[model samples]
Target chain A: MNSLKQMLPEVAPPSREALLEGRGRLVAEARDEAASAGRSRLLKRRINPWTALTAGLVAGTLGVGAALAVQIGGDHRPPERVRLVSAAEVLSRASAVAGADGAARHGRYFHYRWQEISLPDEKSRHVLGSGESWVPAGGNGRGLQRMQPCTEGNAPDCDVVLNYKDGATDREGFTGPRSPKYLRDLATDPDALLARIRRTAKGDGTADDRAWREITDLITESVGTEPKLRAALFAAAAKIPGVVADMNTKDAIGRPGIAISRPGRSPQQIIFDRGYRLIGDRTLAVGKGGPEPGTVLSAYVLVNEDVVDRLPAPRPGLVR
Target chain B: MTLPPALEVRDDANELDMISHVNEQVATDDEIVTWSLRDPEVFATLYDRHAPAIHRYIARRLGPDLADDLMAETFLLAFRQRARYDTARTDARPWLYGIATNLIGRHRRAEGRFWRAIARSGTDAATESLAERAADRVSAQMSLPALTAALARLSKSQRDVLLLTAEAGLSPVEIADALGVPKGTVHSRLGRARRKMREALGGIDPLDPREDAIDE
Candidate 1:
């Protein structure tokens, strides 16, 4: 049984002549796009507003988990920026505070409460979802997760709870949302931690984006309990290429914070409070297709985190 | 402080090094795309980086004769549509492959003919390259006809997913991104396509899991 990749006949790469010709065509296209800047603006004006909005909404739905979004319109304007802080400075400050902020506390479970916004393509309405989870701190006991999706007028009927009887253990090399055992096993040195993240991260996008996503996932799930790990994670994130910080952004819940963003169309921005605590993260739609350049396609805010002895039952009136 | 010729050459080398270092500040694909907004010539960097692979992909599908123009067309279309590129994707391979695949879609009959020609005659434009793989060539010789017939029979979408996996070496996720389809669709289509290929090849499995994992 031959692999398709092997069975397929091998073809030569483009010849030098072909390469030059293709490059020439690309250059020509680029010049034309630049030359027609005015025409593009007029074309943009001619685009139906309703059609553009529909495209954006459709893109938003696809953008939810896949991180792939649409860009519409022709305005090639980059987003405005005032670089008040560098990403290194922000991460350094966060790392400094992380290790000293709180004393070590013992508890049976680590509890986290967060709110996430998702856009289901068909409905095209923002679905606000909340989740609460309690993982056994020792990594060998029952774990509970309660999730609910709510909208403006409809709520209270969709609460769902999941239980992991043998503790919530992440896959051995998984980088996203890990358990205490996984966090403890991670390298504390910044360079090594980043290498490990690169090795294990399974997300889409560039390598740097995947590394940053893994660090953010750790911050969201386990870092609140392990201050030392949180510091290391922040340090690791500071090393990702093309990371920049803006001191004027706000999280999903309107809390002002500094944002560290990767370079991309709808780049994910991680928000940190002035005191250097991770508050939330959001994806900004900066390119043409979907929403306006500054629209937040999806976002998550950490409301509370603590070490609890017992997993509290779902909030009164919220879950049956 | 006049020095020997060797020292002067070293000084000149240092000056050149400094200039090249300044020029070599690498930029991500997204950054290049953004910069191309102001200086369109910057778009040529993307072509230099990806044109060979894109050209080869087109050649394998539609034969080397049309690869020259289609590859240029692919980049031209991408350049025109640069504004719509989801900047969120830092690596432009999927997006470029998508554009190339769309362009390839237009020459569907040409591609079918390409496969049929291979099925009819075991030799292909790539046979010269395949000559090195003597062992694989034996099996490929036996399977090429059946494989081409299977590929010709598959639906456009299924073949797209399968070839993106087999030829472009794109992961399932990347295929989804390139085609603007769901990841699940890539998975299902690839499964069906491979199963058909296996049946066509008398259950030899054109793609053996042990060789390479498709889900990756």
Candidate 2:
């Protein structure tokens, strides 16, 4: 460190003359570029003055006509506009609802759907869809929707079904009939889950599959309801180096939502509604060993308000 | 309140005018950017304002040659992107540093190699080589390699905060803005980096009370 400090003395400050010279040169270059671009624009206008004059005249005429119309307007009063309530106000309202147990249970969940609309040259629009579903708390939650079948050229049919299980535990457990059919079914039994994941992952003999298995194991090892554990999971995820969480604010349906993006590789978006309630999440895996060409990964939706009355009592467990 | 006629008619008028002229010339950085957009020559004023400190920072990190290139690149990139520049930020140093950081990222491998070479050489090339200066140089050199090696081991974010605060002379908030991170994150990373550096430097912690007293 002393040696490094010694080196520090030799680190002379930059020469004032050289810096000034560089600054002058940069200024000169920028001025030249701007001047050239300006000259080009002037030349173009000079070559076609008629078009410019016509456009200017039309614009001037429109301005005068609009001004006169406004002066002689039938209704000078501005239209009544609805003011947008701030996020803070919405959160305060949600907090108040949470404070009242009855109001909390009466909460309804509104789902906001979005799709990517592609354009030419790799540009795409993240367009919000008109389709929405309202799931009410303490209701029999079941719905049927058209889904893609396994057969090719199959028409949209009522193939997909959504069922809301009341009085269900939020804990990680297999949904549907309780049977150890696949690897996920044994997740509740930690030892069995670990053994099966390891065995099956080894047999799979693919790097991507192994990575998934390892991630699953890590998640299982770090799973729990404890806030400390959740924070630990976030920290651990950050340690993976390339993974970054993109947090942005957006309106999910009518409710304020946060869109947390995992971009590029296995891009995913997790939307959290106002009051930090989990709303819906979608992921698109587009690289090697993940999903067929243009195949989106399975999406999950959780409407907190709809499941408020049905959510089982909290189970105590250490996160990690 | 009226001045004496003689005094009022004296060189004070010229002096006051000069002061106001200087003030107008050395306006806020945001004002400079807006002026630069209209007249590119205005950017030279900003380069004059910030280049000394920025040059010194680059010099300390990568030595003179690389520092020159980095400094030039930083200003050039800033000039090219001037159209998209946010005029709201009065202080342009953070924006300049952000550009510098991106340039530094590209040369990360070279940086690691430079540090390793310094560690192996037992003394940085910038250190004094005079016989009379040998004792101090040796002492400094002995610990420097270890320090550089340790610095090389730190995470990019940790290194960024440490270097920005210590060498670039930026405040924590400035560092946060440069890195596009929360201020709390900057503070924590600085603390962690300092601790790690101390630990790596055989427990001669810069923030420790005994060391602080010694420096004082």
Candidate 3:
């Protein structure tokens, strides 16, 4: 039925500007991560001068950050207050409210209606772009998508589709390409879990920065673990060596929250609300176009999330 | 889209910034992956080269928001698995589509609803409204509910083959590759799908319930 072809219009590419802006961040991250495979290869062949030098530099970076944090606090371990509180302190406090209830539902899903606002870091005449979507709880299974491409000069153009994340348990992350089942099987001791996660962590950073970023992945997007696991995840985060506190930050939703950031060439910020719940994150994108490099490339604020039996569709009025 | 003061924070301690200039070289996706093993920076080149299409493909199936989110996941997973990429397969598009399809399959119900909604209305209001090119828009409009309804009636496997062929412009071999099925299986599924579609559209009353039961 060619008639059906007409109904299923040709899918459009995202606006040229939106593609460039968003894709810029992904490319940069890929570049950084891709190098890890080679780095590990070098690490395997111990005693190479360059490898030794790189190792020394990484160790030096972590060593300095941890030394300073510990020096400021003195001889007090867990249950002992980390006087230099950061994400660890906030996460530890939040974990107390933890429970083992998974995100599964009884003939229901965690439905979310969301909007994406894409802003450019360059002055390339790319107007801001915004799009909306409605997703089912998990892959309810079946259908087609008609992606409408938004181009420059056509401000309102955008595509929409439906999603339920296909019921991924641990959600998706770089921590060893494992599933939520992996998290479910993790030890209750946050330290043991952190060690296991560290094995999967990439980057040329200290143990702390690597672990901190991994923790950020867990609480932010993935189907957050059970309460006890979440608590373990946060307590584990506290132990990351270089995590620094940033009490003055807000989520993409503009809600105030405590932020824990790991310093690097491109620092990543993870935000949590006063209630200790995860909210959102921001990354400093240093692209070629902007006058100054550090632009907030991509970020999202969790506006609302709830468990409902029926897939939630935004009222016709809210459809952008 | 400047950030509010509270949402924007920076670290002066990060003095060693990545070189803003990326010396990009034209290379096959395989070469890029190979180079990435030597220099991670090369992965960004692959990202810049391909993520837009990947994003659109996902957006078409799931919508923009999830497209944005899943696009990131797709790349990260791709990055982790780069070592396993078959160098002979220079074009990464099929592989990327496969990754996206698996992700889409996860939310099969949402996709079904999206397709049904368009089918019921016989049009997508949002796209139709701004599709300045009236001629192209008109053809894609007019009547599509029958197609969507028939699509919904097909088993998920059959429907996937049809969409990959129709929507993604993939060949039978690519569809087989993307779905991890044999080429023969892809052809069979597509053949059955086309037959059912022909019956649905060719018949006077596509909406008839009796017609839908013939395939099963």
Candidate 4:
């Protein structure tokens, strides 16, 4: 068996330059941790309210700038022209696109990948993270979720395994009893779906707010799966009171898109590309006891997705 | 034993440097991991000591290009999971190898492609120099495809156990600790892997296969 070690060609250890480059990542993490610690100290004490507000603005500006840099560096495509349109118009466009997309959704597994940036609170470091999942389409079966904390310089395929099991749908953000199959079974009529979403949507805020949240959740989940369901979800969202569309908006990843949002302190906005494709979503920190107004508290951009015939290995007997 | 004035000064500086180096060297990996919880910066010491070996191991498994990214990822992941690391085990090599192995598992397709490419072409991205490839191919031409084909045939678990033993040079017990599998599972997997390799190599024992094809 000793010969097996030598079966492969001799490989040089990483060059000094490569080693340093890799080490730089660890060093940056350390630096971020230290900054997070400092932020924690700042949050714990009572300071002059005006000074606190000023510090928040400065920190928020710097954090948003760094995030924007990451987005710009990763995506080089010219910005799409964003036109301020009525909420009804944006939803209509999205509905038409979804209806016209005749691609059949018939695969054993649905794989979703997205990049997320979140500033959990005032103290914690704003983290850029990404996640991916491979789930069985219809029923309870084996699934895998991979997540990783990413840096501006490097965002590789996730290494952190968040879940691997029969009911990974719950972890994939399809709240209680909501799986891909469940979404597929939902009403396709816009009004009927809106009624069902209002009933199913739970948690804080008014009925419209909760329903809006549910609509976005379904939109994110069913984007690559059920086109008819997606069309209904968008059209349903359009009916929510105070829903508005910002013509000029860019996702956390700096992809220009039309942002459809409802007025709220922490408003969740979904950004769509020119073709009305769901590109990304973000929650803004507006008004008061958080980061400065217009700061994105959390955001995620869809990286890629596919209907894989079979998930990658980890299947015991299914090797090549 | 008299030294020149410049040499004496350099010797004095080296002696002073050794004192600080010795202080750092005294802290075990466990201690550093614990210290890093508070300081965070101390985690770099672990990266400095172990990353080269980890990087090379990955390079062997999945060519050099991917190895760089995965190697960096392994340490970052280790740092993130350091709090959960069982410090009872003083040596972090098994733990680090375990992380590296998991990352390699994700790239199973790329690895399969790498092996299949070699089986078909007798060379891959890792086959560095033309002269080395030419010389190695002469002796290995008959067995190269067989070896690679055999590797591609092994189940992911069997391959992980086998490579942890052969590539990272971990004992079965350490392999168990690294993989979170029982020692019995490791032995059986290793046995099965060796048996597959033997059958592929014209009934020659993989436990003691001929060295004709091996360069190192």
Candidate 5:
């Protein structure tokens, strides 16, 4: 019997080629119908407040233009010597600390880290959702540059980023390097950036105002204490209308810190130290109705002075 | 007995290296869509790549005719969904199998009827063909009635994992993606399905246990 088992090359079932052929024809014919149906559904779509919140969180990690000006030591002058940090440095440090390790690659837009992180949330408590990604840098138009956390099993905790490319809009919430021109200077003369962003949103007249209103709402919702800083930041954001800022404050490995959400249709959050150095970001979406509030999505902490690592491997696989 | 050269080539091509090459080429679901979209004629490339084996799987379950229909439907659906295809994934087989599984689910009644008929007949074309071809036929023909009854009793999720892995040749990760479930869930479901199938078949040793077990 064992010999027979050895002899028989275990035959798998028949392929579904014939079946799929028929379905393909049907789908081609039904494309118009399906598309119409899909369009109708899209038209009736309501604004999901939670989606906006998650988008905000994702934008934070990607380093969107929504910077909060905290009064540090009553220094009114914008710090000339602001230190710039890359996303990769942050991810590496976090990966080492979390002990959920993985490798990362750097791209133009953002640093991609792929690793497993513990989710204290109900939806994915200890579930493994690890994959690679293309995280943007701090600067403008740095293309996607990294891939990490390639694994065999399906990790639902991981976020699959799609259409990440260089010169493309930072739609997915990943950012590039810090602008060579200081943001403080840009804040003073924000017409170029704001107009560019507003034009992208096709903002005209009322639409443009509405876009500005949303930006103001986010600023007020995010940092309401300092009216002066709020006004400055809001002006900057409005200058680049339709460019939403995702922000959050979370505890990374027991340390209080803030994270910027990556921007895109599906946003991700990046963690940072108080010093504004990129630590790591939450790569996975958590919670029940999407990513839950107050959950540690990702963290990149400083292990040593010079070297930093991503906590987990970036989610693997691209969608489009 | 004269050995045919074509048969020899066929045997050589079925080796691990060849299968792995095929697997590597079609490693992710997205790749499959890309390949199909790049050249619609290559749509048949997938069929030529996986049809025989899938045919064998369907034949094992519901004989030949139903298998043909199911297999056809699977590819057709895959082709249609190719546009919104996620290119990150390289293997298209699992996604194709997922669609096929859904179609099979719709024809559950027909499949059940086929199984009952085969069990009563005490002859399954897949099993009988194997018995005829092999020198040793012991345990070659599983109790069709038992297998059919057991399969019918198996939970939908379990059955999905088992069939997808065994017949569709998808990895656990791929199966999870296809089913939109977690990897652990796919593992547990597959395990449960196998255990049930064993129990249902009276723990009869697998008729032709493949060396590469599904889990491995």
Candidate 6:
């Protein structure tokens, strides 16, 4: 028990002087608050006839937590807990899952759809809802989006993000960091493929880090994806020293999965299910300017991805 | 007195190395709080007495970046709320822990992030392990990656109970007061937490009698 307790990393306490300064700050703030309230007393006295109503309003407004409390709530279903296993062990299992789930996916156009959640402010997060894109398998496509309802406060043309129609002449070739043609022709051997990626990757981080990010991004898109390449990608990822395994994680919808992520203040992550199939991606950011830490800066959970001869009509409830 | 080997710093085996000692123990924290109501300056004695441990506990929960700020806040809040101190309870650590725990809860998301990050990075190493054998090593130590992951996976309430008890050395009663939950609830949470953690340890409970036998 002591051994397990010992595992936690200790933070050194604030200096003695810092604590005293904090006390001083709190006292000063309190004095300022009291002084401000002194002026407000005249305003309150004028409104004294309605003081009861005012007090009730204040209490009601502040009782959000009380309002949210559901009395008698009992746990009906406990979440499925993962058995304690070594991170190395979980990663190895996840690698196997990824390898088995990998299959070459091919189609004329790469259509990807996902739900994204973002924090608009510290108070609450907003789900931007499902977003879909169809890129030419060769990396060119024109959008012909159907209009969707705009959010209540949004302008009538708020659906502009969705509603669009373009001529077939309007197109773009995949000019991504790795060219579409180059990606397709890349070797499948984990070593050879990683070497190719390292050679092509140009960035501030080390070649290994750049290679890791490129692989993660490429796998995120299933366009022209192949299972063999996906499996090899996992193998190649395992070779990168930065990528590690975490089973104590959940996808956007609360399904538990293992994750591989980078270290630092804000990290990008890829989540894989117990079966090792890619499930989602999430970015974590420490809330700047406030107490919010581990803010879900953005996240996307994969609904499903498959190649189709043609893009299907928006399905029921997909937009919601 | 046997102290819990908490958040063991690999290089800093000596806790004394981190915090300067005043080498004087006088009034209990509850007494200090009581006296602080009349004279707030006396509260500094309580902070001096307990801030290091509280800071360490907070740091273990939320990491060092937030620890200093949160630790200072905990003491300041203690100073402000000294009037409400329950004199029946002679120890103030539990109450201070309660305050620190609330602060740590604000960073709950970061805790999960750290767990996942540690697991994925595969290097929550304890620097140099103290175990006689690699297999005998305490998984709770940072050297073991999945343990923190397991901790992160615990239901937030359960994690609170486990951490408050294990890290802060608060008795179950103190935890109940600290968390505003019933004693029974604290016990149940601790039970559930340990059970889940035991499973994470491959059915080996660190506190189990069997583990003690292994050490023997």
Second chain TM-score, each model:
0.82, 0.76, 0.72, 0.80, 0.67, 0.77
What is the descending TM-score order?
1, 4, 2, 3, 6, 5
State each model's CA lDDT, in order.
0.66, 0.47, 0.55, 0.67, 0.43, 0.57
Query: Quick one: best lDDT, which candidate?
Result: 4
Compared to the true structure, candidate 6 yields what TM-score?
Answer: 0.38
Off-target runs (Cα >4 Å) in candidate 6 are A7-320, B1-25, B124-136, B139-143, B209-216
Q: For every candidate, how close is chain A to the native chain A in TM-score?
A: 0.59, 0.28, 0.51, 0.59, 0.27, 0.53
Model 1 agreement with the true structure over A228-295: per-residue lDDT tens digits: 77788888888887677654455656565667766452256677875567877776665667755445
Clashes, model 3:
23
Off by over 4 Å in 2: A1-10, A16-21, A44-320, B1-25, B126-142, B202-216
The residue pairs found clashing in candidate 2 are A1-B143, A1-B144, A2-B140, A3-B140, A3-B141
Put the candidates in DockQ order, highest first.
Answer: 1, 4, 2, 6, 3, 5
Expressed as tens digits, the lDDT of each residue in A119-151 for candidate 5 is 554334342433334333322322332323323
Candidate 6 CAPRI grade: incorrect
Q: For model 3, how does the per-residue alpha-carbon lDDT over A1-320 read when each residue is reduced to its tens digit?
A: 23333345555445434544555566567555646656875676666676656755776777774654444334322112211233455566556434323444445554332333333543222213333222333334311111223332243443333332332422222123444446656637987888888887787666666766677777554432345666677777777765555544554445655666554333466566644565656665534555355454556555555455554343342222
TM-score of candidate 5 chain B vs. the reference? 0.67
Ranked by TM-score, the better of candidates 2 and 6 is: 2
Please write out the lDDT profile of model 6 over residues A1-320, one tens digit for every residue.
45455444433444434544554655454455446666686787788768646655765789843433322122233112211222334344444444444242333544555676775444456676664555443334433222223332442212211221221222232223344445546635778888888998766577876887787776665333444555666666667664544434666666656666654422467777644567777765534675344445677777555545675554554332
The digit string of per-residue lDDT tens for model 5 on B1-216 reads: 111111001111110110101001112334334434433433443553455555665655566667776666666666667776666665666666667677777877776776566556644554535423332332443444555566667776777787677655678999988877999999999888777776765554333355223223
What are the TM-scores, per candidate, against the unseen true structure? Answer: 0.43, 0.42, 0.40, 0.43, 0.34, 0.38
Better of 4 and 5 by DockQ: 4
User: Which tens-of-lDDT digit does each residue in B1-216 have in candidate 6?
Assistant: 111111111111210111111121234566556544433444654664566677777766666566768888887777777777778887888889998888888889977776676567644322223222423544433245577678878988998998887777778999999988899999999999999998886765533534444344
Which residue pairs in candidate 4 collide?
A: A1-B207
Query: For model 1, how does the per-residue alpha-carbon lDDT over B1-216 read when each residue is reduced to its tens digit?
Result: 111111101111210010101111245677666656655666765775677788888888888879989999988888888878878887898999999999989999988888888777765674446424433544634466666778888888998988888778889999999999999999999899989887887775655656443223
Q: Indicate whether candidate 2 or candidate 3 has the larger TM-score.
A: 2
lDDT of prediction 2: 0.47
